[model samples]
Each structure stands twice: as structure tokens, then as C-alpha cells.
Target: MDKEQVKKLRAICRDISVLYVEDDISISAQLEKLLRKIFNNVEVEKNGLSGVQSYTKNRQDIVITDISMPVMDGIEMCKRIKLINSEQNILVTSAHNDAEYLVKLIDIGVDKFITKPIDMGSFLSNISKIAISIYREKRETVLESRIKAQQNLQKELLNGIIFPLAYFDEGEIVYANSSFKKQFFTEIDAGDFSRFRLGYLFENKKYVSMSNSELVQEISNSDDKTYLVMDVNKKIVKKYSISVTKFQNAKGCLLSFVNLNALNEEINRFSEQVDYFPKRESFSQALLEPKKSTKENYEIFCVGLKNTKGFIDKYGGAKMHSIFNSLAKSLKKEFSAEVQSKELSIYLFETNRYIFLVEKNLDNSAIDKRLSDFGKKYNYAFGSGLPLELSFIKENIKNTQSIGDILENTEGMLYTLSTI
Candidate 1:
């Protein structure tokens, strides 16, 4: 064998960890030297019985044994090893290079037969083949493990949530979990999702009819971290919110569809503070105010709450708005369907400030109770006022530089009075 070929075979052998077995101690000793040069770790056995012991102890990568031994033959030893690991790689070395011997070895699961004084060239070639096969098998195992890890991570991310998440590639749906697949039409084949792009199901035709130039521009202008809000027309339901986010490490975007109706309802309750507090408003005053009348008008009522800072730290304002939106949806159920003349509204103002506006009949005490409950639930200090008139809406805005100035100098209710 050429020196380069020997060197390559030796490298493979070093990585393989092998066991060598022969009945003749002198022959086995000579073979051990050759094996040592090729493999960094090679264990040799004088007899088949001893070979099985070495093989079991080291659990070597591959085994090579002579068939004619004193106590145990190669076939019997091979069968024992195979019973432990059926896919074991084995080679039989024999002086009798007959077809009958080769057939028998093959039946006993011998990977290859090396006869007589082994040809160094043939030995090198056969070892290379076996090395490649084992490497491929191990590689497949690692790849499968990685895929399973990714699937588990996806499951954990979406746990306890009912939203549908899907993945697509090159204008076709490649894979989707059970939740995501169920969001679309039932009994869909891969071919169906592939044929239909995301735009097919959206009510807005603009998304479907966009030109390639427009698409490119949108992608360029889009924030790498942003999501697309899609309105889906479901078979059973009319519409839902579909959030599409492109994976930073992968091709194609991941789409998560959440029912918008459900979200809206949540927002209403959170904004109205009906989620955590009872809706029964035990106001000291009778509900005698006229039903809200419609005259194009707007109002802004400032509410104060010592944020989580305990009058020292700031409340989580932006996040609070998010939660408030959820609360408002739950609160809407408190109102009758006919009570639509004047609607309750909520907004997050600058810093720890909040603005609320609703019909006058909503007792001030009821609003205070809700605000107090919110403060206690979240553990913060807060204060609120009655709804303001149309003329004073702008002044009551939290960030209005004048708002601080007005509150700093004025008394209750008077602080929000209109200058106009």
C-alpha cells in the first residue's frame, strides 16, 4: 500500500477502536504491531473466547477474528457479539479462502473476509469502506437528536396557548404542527397548502394582488423583527389575527394566528377593569344621570397611580396598557347592548399616567373602586377623577406640559377645568 493510503487507513482506525483475535500467539503478536500503527487503541486476544471478553469489556467499534481457534470458533463468537449489538461490524480472517468458508461467514453476519496472509492493499480498502459506513450511521443518529430537540423547544414555546403556528419555505408550506394545521381548512394535503400562498385566504385583495416590486419594497422597509398582521377568513369564523414573523436563523416566516375577536374581548375587559374586580358598582349615588347623548364630543380624564416604584419607582405603563386592553374586553360584558350612546375609552398617558372617559352615569365611586382594586391587585398607589367635559379634553392629557402645571397649583376637579 502507498504511504498516503496507509496514513488515511491509520487515521480511520484510530477513530474506530477495534479488537483483534487469533489462535496463534506469534501471528497475533505480529498483527498487533500492524494494528497499533493504524489504530491508537487496539486490543488483541490469543483465542476466540478471550476475544469475546475483550470485545465485551471495551465495546469496541469493530471486531476482526480468525475462524479456526482452539476453544471457541469465530462463528460462535460472532453470533454472541451479534446478539448484543446486531448491527456490529465484523471481519473474519481465515487461511482457508474457500467459497464454503466465505458463505458461512456471510451467513454469520461477517462484514468482509480477509484470507491467507492478508493483502495490505485489500485490507486497507476494506477498512476504509467499513469506516465510512459506521461514520454515516453515527451521523444519522446525531441529526435525529438535533431535530427532536428543536421540536421539543417549539412545543415548549407554544405550550398552554391555543394559537396556531406554521412554517413555510419557498412559497410552500413545508411543515406545520397540529395546532397550526387545524387552523386552516380541515383535511388539507401538503399539495393544497403548497398551491395556495398565504394571500389566498386574506379578505384584503391588496395583499394578494401586490406586484413583485411592491413585495420587495415591503420586505426592504419591514423591520427584521416586525410581524405582519393578517386578517384571516376562517371557514367557521369570519376573521382572526394572523401574526407573521420571519425567522432570523431560518428561511421563510413563521405565522401565528390568534382569534382577534377573542383579543378584542380581552382588551375591553382589561381597560374596564372587569377581569379582576366584580362588576357590581356599589356607588353611594343613585344611577340618575341622563343616558349618554350623542353630540360629537371628546374628553380626557387623567388618573394617577403611584407605580410599582411606591411613589418612588415607575409603574409598567406600556405593559399596563397591554394588560388594560385585555381587561377592557372582559368589562364590556357588564354593559347592555343598548348602552352604546357613550362608550368607555382608555389610553396610556405619559409615564405613569392614564386617561379614562365614559358616560356620566358611571358613578365616580365605582370608577374609584375599580382603580383602587387595580392598585391593590398590582400593588401600587393611584388616584383618579370624574370624566372631563369636551372643552377640557386636551388639557387633561398627561404629557401636556400644562397638565403638571395645572395639577401643581389647582384643587380637586378644578385642576382639569377648561381654559377655553
Candidate 2:
């Protein structure tokens, strides 16, 4: 072999340990030197019995042995090794070219064979091949271990998520998280998830009317955004927000659900309060009053209570109404002067919705940051141990459009944010 070939062969064999059994002292000495040069560890045994003992103490990557030995022949030792580990790689060296002996070695699962008065060239070549196979096997084992670890981490992350979630492969339900199983399959036997389809969870006929293929096609062809509302039948109907996203390769998709029935009921109560409040006409008049200059800029904000019904249910509507009135009073106290100065105006649309018209010259980003911070502060201070979150959607009012157009665009933006 060329020097470069020898160098590469040694590099491949460097990490491997070898066990060699030979009764002849001269041959054993020569082979042991060569093996020590190529491998990190070399073990020599004068008999097959000693060889098997050495291997049992510390297994080697490769085993080479002569069939003719004084104690416990190579065949018998190899048979015992095979019983311990069927995948052990063994190389047999023998002086006899007897067909039966060679056949027996092969039956015992010897990896390679070399005849007596071994050819150095063939021996080196076989060693190189075996070394390469060992390296590949080690790599495959490491890769498999890494893959298993990643799978375990993914499973843990999925289980830790709070939302009910499911994964679909093409049209079939491949997996569901613990939350999903508990929420949707409580009465059904576990592992019977295969009986359910993704469409069966939705309330509207829109999803149920389409086949799985059709649904997949629709989701794939569209903007890839999720559907917002889902209905579930328990003792009573419940509403949830559903979010779906396709896998990167387009082979699968994941769905998650967030129950929003409490929030919906709160909004419904706010709608009912509309009949009791008579501030609509005054708020409209205030908003419709002409500005100082037609060239002046302004920003419009549409705000609504998030999950207000849940808050009211937990802390009665009378208390929630008082909180809302207090919030409105606070806003008026802070901004009524600005409204008089043509810099800002706050209008109440319904019990839950408010429109803020502010001077357009204000930095949009700064306003957003301020409002977000203010929302957090207000919720913490006056939320009565409930979240009492709020949603604020904004748009620029560039023209002297009618109140109808302004309200329409504001509601459109709110709807968009709700879906998101």
C-alpha cells in the first residue's frame, strides 16, 4: 500500500482495539507489533481459551484467531462469543484449507478469513475494510441515539404546552397532546384517537361539509392563516379559537384550540348594556364636530374589553360595570382637555367599545408603546384580581370621512386582530 493509504488506514483503525490469538510465538510477535501500530489497543493470547477470557473482560472491535490452538480451538471460542453478542465481528486465520473447517467458521458468523502464511497485502486490505465498517457502525449508533433524544425532547415540549393541540399527517390524525385528549376524548377509550377526524371538532357546517382532501387543499391553497371560531358540544355548546399551521415540508399540519366561551358571553352582556346607555348620541355629536383645520392629521383607536364576560362571571357585572365606568372617568379626566384643544377625543360606541381620536402628529410607535404599558398598569391596579385585558386596534384618519366609514374601518381592524 502507498504511504498515504497506510496513513488513512491507520487513522480509521486508530480508535479500534483488537484481540489476536496465535499459538506460534514468532507470528504472534510480528502481528502484535503491526496491530499496535494501527490500533490504539492490541491484546495477544497464546490460546483460544485465554482469547475468550480477554474478550469477556474487555471487548474489542475486531477479533482475529487461528483455528488450530492447544486449548479451546478458535471455533469453540467464536461460538461462545457469538452467543454473548451475535453482532461481534470476527476474522479467522487457519493453515488448513479444509472445506469443512472453513464452512464451520462461516456458519459461526466469521466476518473474514485468511489462509496460512498470510499475504501481507490481503491482510492489510481486509483490516482496512473491517476498520471502515466499525467506524460506520459507530456513526450509525450515535446518529440513532441523537434522533431518539430529539424525539423525546419534542414529546416533552408538546406535552408541556397548555393548549389542546393535535397534529395531522395529510388527512389522518397522527398525534394529539395530553390536553387535547383530556378535552375532546374524555369519555372515549385512550388510543382510539384514530376514530376522530379534524373536521369533526368544528361547530359550523363549513368544515364538516368538506372532505379531508378538500379541507387540506383549501388550507394549502389559501393564505395559510388559521380559522378563528370553533364550536364544541358538551352539556351545552362552547366556543373556542382554533389556530392551524402547516408543517414546513407540507406533509402535515398542527391545530391548537383556546376556549373563548367566557369572553364571548362577556361581549354579549356588553351588547345588552347598549340599550341602557344613552351616551351614543352625545359621543357621535362630539366626534362629528368640525376640526380647526381640514389639513390637520389624526389617529383613530378602536378599543374593546378582552374576556370581559369571564371577569363579570367571576366578579359580578355590577362590579365590572363600576370598573368600566371608573376607567371611562379616568380617561375623560386625563384627556378631556386634549379633546377641547382639538388634540384628542374619546367616544363610547357600546358598553365595551371606545373610539379615541388623537392628534395625527403623535408618533404611532410611541402611542402604541404607551397604550400597551397603560393597559398593563390599569389591568394590574383596577382589574379586581382578574386579568380584565383589553384589545386596542388603531387606524389613521386621513380624510374628513363620515362617522360610518371610520367606524367600519375601525371594526374591520378589530376583527382582524381578534382572528390573529
Candidate 3:
């Protein structure tokens, strides 16, 4: 390997703890010095017996052993270690170059090998590769454990509550409580939610069946952010009192639901608390109806964020909201202060989507320059350095009476201006 790669690998080795077993005093002493320089902790054992004992106590990140030893051989020690932890990472150094003996070590699940009379360079490179692999595997194990803990906590909270609830993350359903899951999903679709569809809840009857995106869009657009779904299982059509929460900490909203037959105080209490999703009806109305006295036309800029999942994963949900709010405020400031003879009205269509309306007097070139400038300034908004991309689509309603005509005549759908 190159020097740069070896240097990087050596950095990774700082986190790794090692157990080295060698019968020869000279070899063990030399190797231990080199290993101690890179590895955080190095435990040296004279023979396989002591190695096994030390491993039982420490369970180090890596185990390096000599094949031939006094009390027990490296193969035997590996077999016992495998019994203790099946996923243990073991590297064997062997002078004996027999194919059958190597096959035996492979069968015992030895991860790597360095032949006798070790080239110090090759040895360091191999150990570095194994070190990185072990590090990544352990990191994944920790991440999965954290995710499970969060899910368990959510499940406990959801199960205790009487109401059935499902939550969304950026217009996509991430989780639903047990009550919601049991009521909605079938036995076949229990563990695997890849084929999860809201339409499956009521197959035969259809009131207003929409995709996750469509549902979220409706919630964002309407003043009454509640969806009244019917429980078709009962003889009497039971109406559900639904409300989308204004929980600001999260990127998505909590969908609170209760039966209409429940106490008036409970429904009203929920409505009072979570009813903060304001209706963005002005833009939609502007699309259809024109101001008769002025007869003004608007230039439409349809904007969206690209690869939002990766952005959210890196920066988190609250940061994602800050990004959107920051963009909205910047656009508002630009239109209100700088741009002359132009009025701007912006509507947050979805979590990562926006509709911008500016006076149609300015041509596409002017809008492009303004958007490009705004994008450049926004890139350096915070010292945190957010890699935010704004996908803009330009369509003018200059001579055309309606926005529909602009949509019909538009060539391109969207253009991503900024990049990470």
C-alpha cells in the first residue's frame, strides 16, 4: 500500500486494542514494540493458553497468534475463541506453509494471515485493513442498537396511549404505533413494510385514498388539517377526529387521531394544542383567479431540494427546518428590499418544495441572475456550512392569462442550481 493509505490506516488503528501471542521472546518483543506504537492497548501472551485467558478477560478488538505454541496451538486457541464469540476477529502468523493447515485455520474462521519472516510493511498493511473492517462493523452494531432502543421507546409510549397514531418524516411514513399497525397492516405485512400502502387499510371502500405525498400535500394546503377517515369494520360508520400536530422540534408532524364519539373535551383539547398548520390558499387562489382591476401577471419559480434524505441524515430534522425557513426568509428579503417593480408571494407546497410568484415584467434572465445571487449568498449564511441545493424551474405567465398555460408550454421541469 501507498504511504498515505498506510498513514490513514495507522490513524484508524488508534481505536483498536490488540492481543498478540508468541512463544519466541525475540519475535514477541520486536512485534509488540511496533504494535504498541499504533494500537491503543496491546496485550502480549507467551503461549496460546495465556492468550486464551487474556482474551477471556479483555475480548480485544484483534487477536494475533503464532501457529505453533507450547501448551496449545493457534488453531486450537482460535476454535475456543470462536466458541466464546462467533464474530471475533483473529489473525494468525504461521511459519508452516502447508495448504491443509491453512484450510484448518480458515475453517476455524480466522480472518487474516501473515506468513513467517514477516515483511514489516506488508504486515502493517494487512493489520490496517482488518482494523478498518472491525471498526466499521462495531460502529454499525452500535448504530443498530441505538435505532432499536429508540423504536422500543416509541413502541412503549404508543402502546400505553388509547389513540391510534402514525407519524411521518418529510411527507413519508417512518413509523406507526402498535395500535395503528395492528389495525392497518396484515399478518403478511407485519415485519416487512416495503409494500406498505395506506389504501390497504380499507381495500373495498374508498373515501379519499391518497399516497403518503398526496396526504402530506393536502395537510399543508388546507386550513383544516384533519382527515376524517371512516372505520368500515363497524356496522355503524365510525368517524375519526384527526389532527396533524404542530410539533416544531421534529421535521415532520405528529398525526393525532381520536374517534368522534369520544368526549367533546378530549377532541377540542387535541385541536387546540396541535392545530398550527396554516392554510396556504392564497397561491392556489392566485393560480386560478386573476385580480380584475390591476390585471397583473406573475413569473412562477417552482423550487425543490435535491437528495433531502442525505441532508437530513447529516444535519438532522431541526436543521432541515432551519434550512427551509432560512431560504424562505432570504427570498422574502430579496423580493421586498432589492428587486424593484416586482412583488413576491411564496407558498411552502411540501416539506422540500416551494412555489414562488414574482411580477412577470422581469424576464427569465433577470430571475436567473437574482436566484443565482441569492443561492450564492445563502450558501455562506451560517458558519456550519450547509450544502443546500435549490432546484428551480422557470415558467413565466407574461402574456398567458393563466398559470395552466405556462405549465402546458414549459419545456423543462426542474433545474438543480446549488450542489454539495
Identify the candidate with maximal TM-score: 2
TM-score of model 1 vs. true structure: 0.48
Q: Positional deviation of 365 in candidate 3, in angstroms?
A: 90
Residues 1-420 of candidate 1: C-alpha lDDT, one tens digit per residue:
778977777765566788888877777877778778877878888777888888888888879899889789888899888877888899888898677767777777776888868876777677678877776777788899999999888767764456766666655666666666555534444447655455545455666775423443454455652333343324544345545677687767666676666677667655555333232121101112222223323233554432223223234544455434433443344333313544554433322233455444555455556555543454212232222112112222232234344344323333343222
- For candidate 1, the per-residue lDDT at 11 reads 64
User: All models: lDDT?
Assistant: 0.58, 0.74, 0.69
Worst 10 residues of 2 by lDDT: 228-237
lDDT at position 224, candidate 2: 42
Judged by whole-model lDDT over C-alpha atoms, candidate 3 comes out at 0.69
What ranking emerges by TM-score with the best candidate at the front? 2, 1, 3
Model 2 scores a C-alpha lDDT of 0.74
The sequence of per-residue lDDT tens digits that candidate 2 reaches over residues 1-420 is: 988988888888877889999999988888888788789888999888999999999898899999889979999999988887889989888889899998888888885899979888888888888989999888899999999999989978998986788787766677778777766663552557566655655555687777665665665566643454333324344566665677676787887777676666567656644433335466556556666236665787776667677777887776777677656655566555665785666667656677776776656677577667767766522636667666788887767666787667766865765443
Q: What does candidate 3 score on TM? A: 0.48
The C-alpha RMSD of each candidate to the native structure, in angstroms, is 15.0, 13.1, 19.3
Q: Which stretches of candidate 2 lie over 4 Å from their true place?
A: 186-189, 216-237, 261-420
**TM-scores, one per candidate:** 0.48, 0.58, 0.48
- What is candidate 3's lDDT per residue for 1-420, written digit by digit as tens? 676875777787877899999998988889999898778799999888999999999999999999999999899999999999989888889899999889998998885899988888888878877898988987899999999999898789887787778777765567777766655555555666655555434323442477765665555566864444544334243455566775767787766667666556455544532232222465556556445115565566777665566767876765666665656556656766433443555665555556666765546577778777777666622445555666677665665454555444432333232231
